[model samples]
Target: MQVKRFFAADMRQAMKLVRDELGADAAIIGNRRVAGGIELTAALDYPLQPAEPVKPNAALEAELRKTQAIIATAQARLSLPEGLTAKKDCQLFGERLDDFKNDFTGADHVANRVAEPAPEVVGPAPVAPHAYESASQDARGLDIVRSELHGLRELLETQLGSMAWSNMQQRQPNQAFLWRRLQRMGLPATVAHDLLAKVAGIAESQQAWRMLLAHFAQAVDVVRDDPMDEGGVIALVGPAGVGKTTTLSKLAARHVLQHGSQSIAIVSMDSFRIGAQEQLKTLGRILNVPIIPVGADQSLTQALAPLAQKKVVLIDTAGLPAADPAFRLQLEALASRGLRSKNYLALAATSQAQVLKAAWHSYKQCRLAGCVITKADEASTLGEVLGLAIGQRLPIAYFTDGPRIPDDLHRLRAHQLVSRAVSLQLAEEPSEDTMAAMFASFYNDLSRKVG
Candidate 1:
């Protein structure tokens, strides 16, 4: 094999010279621009020996004939344009020659005149395909790539959205209601509706949930934040066994374990749940902190008032039925107490998105500083709850995974939450057994319905 470099102003000229020098099958290795000319590198192969010729069958002979005919037709058509140009030039040259020659002849004057030039007949150019079809196919391919890239972007965003952090807390005993009220006024529903529509596709749960998470993160990004660090006596409020009491206890323990128990005052706002007050009282005693026992809603103001010496006065609020009117009234007392509070709604990540939103709305007054994502270790899908929390703009203040008091509690991190959501999405995908069962159930239903 030998390689040669050719210089031409354009590809067509270069290719023509290449074909003239080497046979048509010569390989074009490379091409580039060099100064005033285009450079093309090509290689030609010469076999060492010819192989034994195979006998040509009838089909092969027919193909060869067709190929030769097509080549001949192209070559014939190719000659007509150059030939017409030549004929026009020859007629003009003869006319010029006649002007000189005609002066020399009085006889043969008719012969001296240039022969009348024949009218050139033009043939139609070979039909070429219109440009639109090629362009349309290219555009369609580009659209598919764009769609895939867009999908990947949405998936990544859904995995990265987390909540706003707050450093402020309320010191007044009844501030739990104030936090609830603040959270109610959070971002509008239109935010969720629009962003969710972007990532949500018409697919089954297993295939579509990642997109759901993506839009949910976008939805949460709309809620703005303010400084949440004021030391107000706010309480952890939620439904029973929602880990409110445990969450409250964790706060108290951390305050004591991090700062001396005496630095963080404990206020027991839960007079309803049996032994709820006792639980806080026991924790307070264990940490050697004062437990200000308050009974009625009005009593909260007085108990929280004496805790000014404490750095953070944490109120252990009772978890009531979310629908209780009395609990609403009690939570509303935070405003009357003139205290600022953040109502942290404790939520289990295993709950469905709809249920989580309901839980958020149920305490619609607690200005839910966001949420306390609890029992993260128990759920397979954090996206549902995280989507709910972000969708609500209620930043996670804490993430509690286990019963281990201080060790299990962590500040809400968006990346961690989204990563967990992605994992949960993968985990939630139906297994082979699940798919088979689903098909079996579907067939049974179809059979009954059809019959």
Candidate 2:
């Protein structure tokens, strides 16, 4: 047998070197971690007749078979109990087997050629097929065990959560009822838990319920006066389809109705969307307000400079995505110290909690003066928007229930908003299992906070 030692930064590179120099029939006799990486000792039967097929020497064949058997045993041992450590071991074993292959056979033959240096040898030995089959069986078994353990873990968590919920109902029935009520109202777990924690000592159910609503209403911040009446230069900012244009029209119409149309001017900064400028022009025509169209190349400050005589210059911005370059440009323009613009985020009440939150985070970069809750009449529930308003302390300015210009807009009232939210609560309570899962998560959060 001809023996040669190869060194590389890793097993894969070492195996590649062995294959390239010694051809694919090389067998890895021994391998160990060296100073830089891996050192592999490979051997191949030599002094063969070129006319006939090369046959490995008996001693070397036996050693290769012994090595294959050892590798098979190790792979079998990889079927350890399902856990983080065991999963890591299985992954490491599979990776090592793949590295040994190194484009010799292909990824599918990772389990084949157990002691071979290359993934695919020029000609596999007689023992290779058996080794491949055995290793493949071990890997499949490990996968099956891992899947079963994952299912078992999920089942265990569900059962434990259910048990914990039942125990909590027995110990603190009032608190449990409140949790269910809050969950049914579609309030986020963190917000509901904070309320529950605050009213933990209130044993009486009715009083607890009353206090919860009171606390919820108190959390909703609102502007002291109608924003339309006190506007200098107010810009409506939010994601697309949230009624920024409609809300701006409503505000302008409201101002037109109360004060003369001459004091207000609608500056259309939405040059991107088709007919967006036309829509504002139409509204301006109906309301008899001046429509100043700012083109894409026009500076917003210079545009506003011409309208300095106008009292309430409602900047109707393009409802582009927060990440868009144009959107950031508009935000930076609105936040400029020269304009002194008070930006109000136009959030649709019908949007999901996450969507509303994302909108708030996006527009908040411009230092939001307040939020205008639009599409209230179309929303199934107001809890999500209310939760966002309360959590962010974003003062609610005006809410529009319909598409009507001035009639649909109403000033913010905390108690009325809370009542509207409570009225939209789910008629049926959540399932015991669902409640149990929620409670488990809530308690986990509480524990973490306490710790």
Best by lDDT: 2
lDDT tens per residue, model 1, 31-117: 665686567788898444665664333432343344344334433432343224322322332332233223223212322222223
Q: Kindly list the per-residue Cα lDDT of model 2 for residues 1-451, writing each as its tens digit.
A: 8899999865545767999989999887766666987788888975444565433334434533443444455345443343323124324434433332232232223333333443555775566568667666656544443333333323333443454566557666897899888877778777886787778789999899999999988888888887677768998999889999988888888788888888999888888886777889898889889898887678998888888887789999888886788888889999988888989988898899889989988888898998989998988778788888878888999889998877998885899888878988888988886786665455444444544
The TM-score obtained by model 1 is 0.47
Error of 2 at 437 (Å): 3.6
Q: Which ten residues in a row have the lowest lDDT in candidate 2?
A: 99-108
lDDT of each: 0.54, 0.73
lDDT of 2 at 435: 82
Question: Model 2 shows how many backbone clashes?
Answer: 4
Give the TM-score of each candidate: 0.47, 0.66
